[model samples]
Target: MILFRRRTLLLSFFVAMLVFSMYLMMSGNYPKVIYRDSGVPDAEKVSTEDSIDSTDIESVISTNGSGRDFFVEYRLERDRLRSQEADYLREIINNPNASQESKDKAQKDLIALAEKVEKEMNVENLIKAKGFEDAVIILSGDSANVIVRSEGLSTKEVAQITDIVTRTTGLSMDKITIVERSN
Candidate 1:
């Protein structure tokens, strides 16, 4: 009976993973995790010392407005996931054993990823080079969002961001959003 129980658990785990991988392949945003909120308090933060300096962490949790660090971390994570999706597509495209249909789809996905990555990187670079402390640019189908880390923004600051985005993207006024996060 113990042996049978072990076999059943392994089979269930395999089936669950197969379903997950299939779902990931079909989605354009391949791996933005879908989590149902369970009302359980996180134990990690609860037990941690409160005096740790945030700048030391470097990646996330920067000192300043919590919202600023939030956007920085979100953009970093989103780009990473998109990169992984691109890798998966590239593998399929390069696989000699892949079906022609699968190869064609992978090729298309690769092009899409390339264009998106280029735009995102260019926008972020231009924004940061233009004096923003840090910037994350998210371009959707028709519009773009520029999330910047700063100590809030003034009218001149907003105009500067808008002008830079318009010049860089050739996007009209309504198509660009400039968000300032204090940090």
Candidate 2:
């Protein structure tokens, strides 16, 4: 009877151990499954390049928008600056309290500011060096009651160039006019 009881105890212990091991494996605590779908096929399977359609390639290209947004954003910013400049010039001219010396000083300051802005906007070197053939540079200055012509550049390009030149020249961005040229 003692021998039989000992054998039964040993068998029960083995069964419990087997159940625990199985539970661990099924519960994902143990790495039971060795293989998974890696998305890439094995050497025996056909490749993805051969299966993809031409339309998929076209779709990818179409999804990438062009530089139109950059151009528009650049234009709007330029126009805002131009308006501000006009308003500033008007204020200076209309101020009756300003003495002759003060007016002369203001005029000189405006010219110097415009020239500095123009020099900064001069991205001819950068545009040419960067190989941006589509780009055009335009310049404007603070000479009141005089029409200044840019080398056939669009008003937008002019403003953009002005902005760039001002930034490069460390002048106030608001004081400069940048415009874009339309081809």
Candidate that would win on lDDT? 1
- Misplaced by over 4 Å in model 2 are 1-68, 124-130, 133-183
Put down candidate 2 lDDT per residue, 1-183, tens digits, no spaces.
853564365446445645854684487532223223453434533222312222322332333243232222332333344435534644674589877676656555444444433442345434433333333233433211111223465656555555544555555656544333332
Where is model 1 more than 4 Å wrong at Cα? 1-68
Error of 2 at 112 (Å): 2.7
Candidate 2 TM-score, true structure as reference:
0.30
